[model samples]
Structures are given as structure tokens and as C-alpha cells.
Target: MAERILIVDDEPGILHALQRLLRHGLSAPDGSRYQVDECANGALALEQARRHVYALAISDYRMPEMNGVDFLTALRTLQPDCERIILSGYADLNALVRAVNEAGIARFIAKPWADFELLSAVRQVLQVRDLVIENRRLADLVRLQQGQISAQEAELRRLERLEPGITHVNWADDGSFILEDPGDVKL
Candidate 1:
């Protein structure tokens, strides 16, 4: 599946640059492919995210209506699976900490981030999201297998009563098995 990425920033230049950089090397979590979306502000970003599933979201921390942290925090409640990244020129350690703890941000990038560096960070966040989803799928599979095993175990217990000395039971049709005592038998 192609991973979906959403970029939210008020600045047109920064948004365009980042979008171009990401597109050049875009790939799925399995190294297959990627699909990306962009929004000029947090409101549109939130709207898009609600309608679709995004592997990751990158947003600027300063905007008129909503800031990155606030936007991400709202998104967290709606789509808990989506990974978040906060990019900002203002270096406020306290706000970053709150965003990380409250919104579950995957990474934080400064506004004047290197092109390659930004791409690398985005890649890492997407990779982590993929791993998390994969892990959940595997866990569900394990639980399903466990349920089957439990059912088989119950069947085995019922078979044991019918054939005490038999190690296995094969029934062509649903019928009860009768075992004769060893000493009392007609030759």
C-alpha cells in the first residue's frame, strides 16, 4: 500500500520546497511507492486527514487560526494511528515537549531544515508508522490462531473419553465410539 503524507504550512515557499523534495524520493514503507497531499493551513489539513488515512503529517507550528501542536492534538483524537511532525522557526522547548507528550509527535524539525535532512526525517516517521501497523496486524493474526488452537484442544479432550488408549481419532461421520474392556471380550 502506498503511504499517504500530508504537509501543512502557511508559507507557500516552504510548503512547495518540502513537497518537491519529498516527491523526488517518495516511496512506500515497503519501498514500493507513496502518495502525498498538501494544505496551506491547519483547518484544511484536519479536514483532509479526517476523510483519509495518512501515514504521516508535517505541519508548521505558527499559523493564524491554528498552530501545529493544537492541530496535531485535535487530529490525535480523531486518527490515533497517524504519525505527526511539527516544524517551526520558533524554538520553544516547552511547547515542543507538550506537543510530543500530548499529540504523540513522531519527529520535530526546525523551520530552516536541510532538504535531505527533512526528507530523511519524514522517511523515518513513515517507516515507524508502517512498523506499528504491521505489528498490530501480526498480533491480531496470533490471537486468531490461538482461538483455533483452543477449539482443537476442547475437541481433543472429548475424543480422549471415547478412546482412552487411542492417540488419535478419525471419524468419517459424527458418531460415538465404544471401547470394550480388555478382559471381557468374545473371541
Candidate 2:
């Protein structure tokens, strides 16, 4: 399945341009991947994001409705795993800092960004998201294995109690099996 990306920019030109550029630039190793969606405002972006699972969201900072920071904060509430990027013409230091701290932006693409850089940023953030999901999966696997191990240990202990005096059988040191019954076995 192709990863989905949602671009939210109040500028119609930037929204469509990014949609076109990203749709063409992003491709899987087999040259087939990605579904890009564009929205003109944060309200529509939020609604669309709720309906679809977006791998990454690139939003412009200054918007008429909700700004990028507010939109991102809202998005995080709905889709905590989706990666976020902020794009802005105004590189205001305060705005950037607020976006980073409040919105949890993965990347900040300045206006008039190089195509390669933009693609690279998106790729890097997606890679990071993949790693995070994989880590969580591995941790769950480990937890499951630990639970199984504990159950097996408990079963072994139970069996040991049920079969008391059954451990004295002597087998040849070399590869061989020897069975000796408890002389007066009781249940």
C-alpha cells in the first residue's frame, strides 16, 4: 500500500504545486507509490485526515482559519503517529520555535525549498516513523515471548510437583535414552 500524504496550505498555488511535485517525486523502489491529497485550509485538512490515514502532513504556517501549529496540535490528537512538517514563507524564529514545541514538527521546510531537500525531508521523517513502528512491534513480540516463557516455567514447576521422585533416571552420558520407573509409583 502506498503511504498517504496530506498537504494543507491556505495558498492555492502552494497547495497544488506541492501536491503535484510530491506526487511525482515520491516513488517506491519499484517506482510505484504514494497518494497525495491537498486541502486549502486547516478545517478541511483536519476533516480529511480523520477520514484517511496520512503518513505525513505538510502544512503551511500562516493560514486564514487555524494556523499550522494549531492544526498540527489538533491532528496529533486524532492521529498521534502521523508525522508532521511545517512549511512557511515567514521564517519567524518565534513561530518556528512554537511550531516545534507545540506541534511536534518533524521537519521545517522553508519557503522556496529545493525539490530534492523537500523530498529528502519527507523521506527521512517517514523512515523515522517506520523505525518507531517497528520498535513498537518488536517490543510487543518480546512481551509476548516473555509471557509464554513464564507460562512454560509455571507448567514445568507444576509438572515437577505432580511427578515427584521421577528425576532419578540415569541416562548414558553419550547420546542415549534410559527410562527408570519410580519403584512404587503413586498416582
lDDT of 1: 0.76
User: Where is the poorest 10-residue window by lDDT in model 2?
Assistant: 159-168
Where model 1 places Cα greater than 4 Å from the true spot, the runs are 30-32, 148-187
lDDT leader: 2
lDDT per residue for candidate 2 within 122-154, as digits (tens), equals 889988987886675566557567784464555
Q: What TM-score fits each model?
A: 0.75, 0.76
Tell me the deviation in Å of residue 139 in model 2: 0.8
The residue ranges of model 2 lying beyond 4 angstroms of the native Cα positions read 29-31, 148-187
Which pairs of residues collide in model 1?
Answer: 28-33
Candidate 1 lDDT, tens digit per residue, 1-187? 5667888999899888878878777776566766778899888887776567677788899889988999999877656777899999999999899889987898899979988888888878777877776775566556557784464555454444233334443444558655555344221
How much lDDT does each candidate structure score? 0.76, 0.80
Q: Model 1 — TM-score against the truth?
A: 0.75
Judge candidate 1 at residue 182 and give its lDDT. Answer: 37
Q: Quick one: RMSD of model 1?
A: 18.9
